[model samples]
Target: MREARPLPQYLVQRYHGWRATAFVENRVWYRRLADDGQHPRAMVIACCDSRVHVTSIFGADTGEFFIHRNIANLVPPYAPDGEQHGTSAAVEYAVNTLKVAHIVVVGHTNCGGVQGCHAMCSGHAPELEEKSSFVGRWMDILRPGYERVTPLPPEQQIRELERQAVLISLENLMTFPFVKMAVESGNLSLHGVLHDIAEGMLEQYDHQAGGFAPIV
Candidate 1:
């Protein structure tokens, strides 16, 4: 096994800076959170892309949101085969234990995972098509999404595929028994959103309209 090393100097300096400022200023709140435990009202499943900051976008406090990040913000269909499933585990915990009122899947523009899925589905990414490739397998969850946008132009397909990631995850979330129960009983709500990094725009899926609309 590879030995772990200490944090890089830059990260250490940033940690120290945060500890001195944010941590010190909110010491009491932090302590309260430690003692009381987190009671986040929403669980946000967002892309692991560094630019998509879920907390910053919502202006959320430290314990205000329970967040999970994965490539392309994809959530696979409900599979209970006794295998290791990180995204499913997080969803189960959030719904059953945390009892969060909201579950939001946040997809973003220019997602590498989405682009990879497009390439793989188009037979251009042989490396990702290999069985040994984890990302390739993970992206297989979005294959249906790719099929939905096949008639579009290549560039448009990529853009639509990004939104489809959010829609697919939202649909997959309903496959989870607990999530479905909560939504049926009006205890939990599901939301899908797309964030355009460069344009600084956010569009939310509209169930009635059957497409996404700006939050305005």
Candidate 2:
């Protein structure tokens, strides 16, 4: 095992990370003290990949948004069952508990899960026999997005697929009871966003236009 080293040189001016209380400091502790009482204005459902951090991308100030992360940021269609449904539960909580005014599903370019799903859609993978593996199943969420973007060229297809996945996840969000209720009551709004890490660009879904437009 690696030995515990002293704090890195970057800690010079900074006494400690947790010691300085940002808006999010001790939030989990607050949650422990029955302070989990829903107050965030937005809920972001995003990918677990390091590159897809919505907090950093959106400049979220911690308590401003509730967040849920998953393998690919895809929300599966509603199905009442005993399956592991943490993402769905978080959505429920944000709508039912936090009563967040907005819900955003963020997807990014060059996502490994998206690439793997694209490969699977192209029928080029050699491991179809054991399709129950983690990535294989995770990519299943992208199946429909893959089909929709098939006609575009390779590069364009990827861009379109990423956009479509965000839309699909947004649609999936509406399938939940709490989300639907919030939408119907005009208390919640849904959005889909695409993050271009390479270009440092963020695009918001223009549902009427049916395409992503730069946020700025």
- Name the candidate that leads on TM-score: 1
User: What lDDT is obtained when candidate 2 is compared to the true structure?
Assistant: 0.80
Q: What is the TM-score of each candidate against the true structure?
A: 0.98, 0.82
Per-residue alpha-carbon lDDT of candidate 1 for residues 1-216, written as tens digits (9 for 90 to 100): 479889999999999999999999999999999999999999999999999998999999999999999999999999999999999999999999999999999999999999999999999999999999999999999999999999998769999999999999999999998999999999999999999999889999999999999888
Candidate 2 error regions (>4 Å): 1-17, 20-38
Distance (Å) between predicted and true CA of 18, model 1? 0.9
Give the runs in model 1 whose Cα sits over 4 Å from its true position.
none
Give the distance in Å from residue 85's predicted Cα in candidate 1 to where it truly belongs: 0.2
Q: Pick the candidate with the highest lDDT.
A: 1
Q: In candidate 1, which residue pairs get closer than 3 Å at backbone N, Cα or C atoms, i.e. clash?
A: none
Q: Write out the backbone clash pairs for model 2.
A: none
Q: What is the C-alpha lDDT of each candidate?
A: 0.96, 0.80
